[model samples]
Target: MREFLIIGSKAKTDKFSLNDLPGAGRIDILCRCVSSAFFLSHDIRRDVNVYLLLLGPPDPPKVIKIVGREVKYMPPDERGIAGLIRKALEVKADESWKKSSPGIYVAKKGLEELLDETASDVYYLREDGEDVRDFETKDGLFVLGDHKGVPRELEEIILSKAKKIIGIPTKSLMAEHCITILHYELDRKQLNS
Candidate 1:
């Protein structure tokens, strides 16, 4: 399965207002990234995993994992998505790594820990990196940053751990857009192979 990690530098760990998801001021981008990661054509979903490294709130840092195939109900809107994530976090805050539902898990581990545990090859997405089309397509983990981009310290760690630094050869797309393009490219390559 393909894995995508989104680092939310200011995403709150606490519960947020469902009515004001965009105005809630904590998880707007996080919600958007999640929505993009899971959305597909004709309501079909992709078999993938999304990891959110939330760095805002009372707890500071927390990792939220969502499995696509296991998701019982995926919200089409940012508000509902944010609510789902908020509820998941609230229900699984204490667990180190426990399933709150069929497709969702909350873990105490941060980005570094999660990357180390995954057996898939890790690829860090950046504009200056090599073009993805030129690289061999395979099941792997793709690490991305939120609006503000990955933190400097974490980027350093990611660079060291990544099997490759892949680029899209554009002016830098949104995290979700990057996912879609990468999946399309990889899927096409797989089909041809």
Candidate 2:
């Protein structure tokens, strides 16, 4: 499976209204990231997983895990996905993951703990990294930052753990766009294989 971990540096951890997703530290961006990660023309990519690492006010460091294979009732729109995230935030969580809704899990885990849990090859997405077109695409974990970008300290840790830093051979792009491009590359590789 392909896994995506998006670092929402300023995304709110507390519950947010569906109407204020963008204002909620650009939760809209995170929602879009989710949509891009799993949604296709007529179906959801059940083999993918999207992780949102939210670090914002009131409460911080909430990780929202969306498992595609198990996820049901996920709407194709941004507002609908945001609703799911809002509901997840409402559920009280500890270090352990708590299921708030179908296929959505919330926890108080931060970046370091999450890195420890994933056993897949970790690839950090950066504009200056190796061109994605030059490498083989396979099942692995892809790490990226939201609009605010990953924290400097956390980025250092990511670089240390990443198997390689991969990028689309272009100028800086939006986080969601990067996800779409990555998915396209992976899909092409899958089809050709």
Give the alpha-carbon lDDT of every model.
0.80, 0.91
Judged by lDDT against the true structure, how good is candidate 2? Answer: 0.91
Determine which window of 10 residues in candidate 1 has minimal summed lDDT: 20-29
Write candidate 1's Cα lDDT for 108-184 as tens digits: 77777888888889999998889989989667889988788888998998998999999999788888788888888
Q: Compared with the true structure, what per-residue lDDT tens digits does model 2 show for residues 6-54?
A: 9998899897878888889999999999999989988999999999999
Candidate with maximal lDDT? 2
TM-score of candidate 2 to 2 decimals: 0.97
Model 2 misplacement above 4 A: none
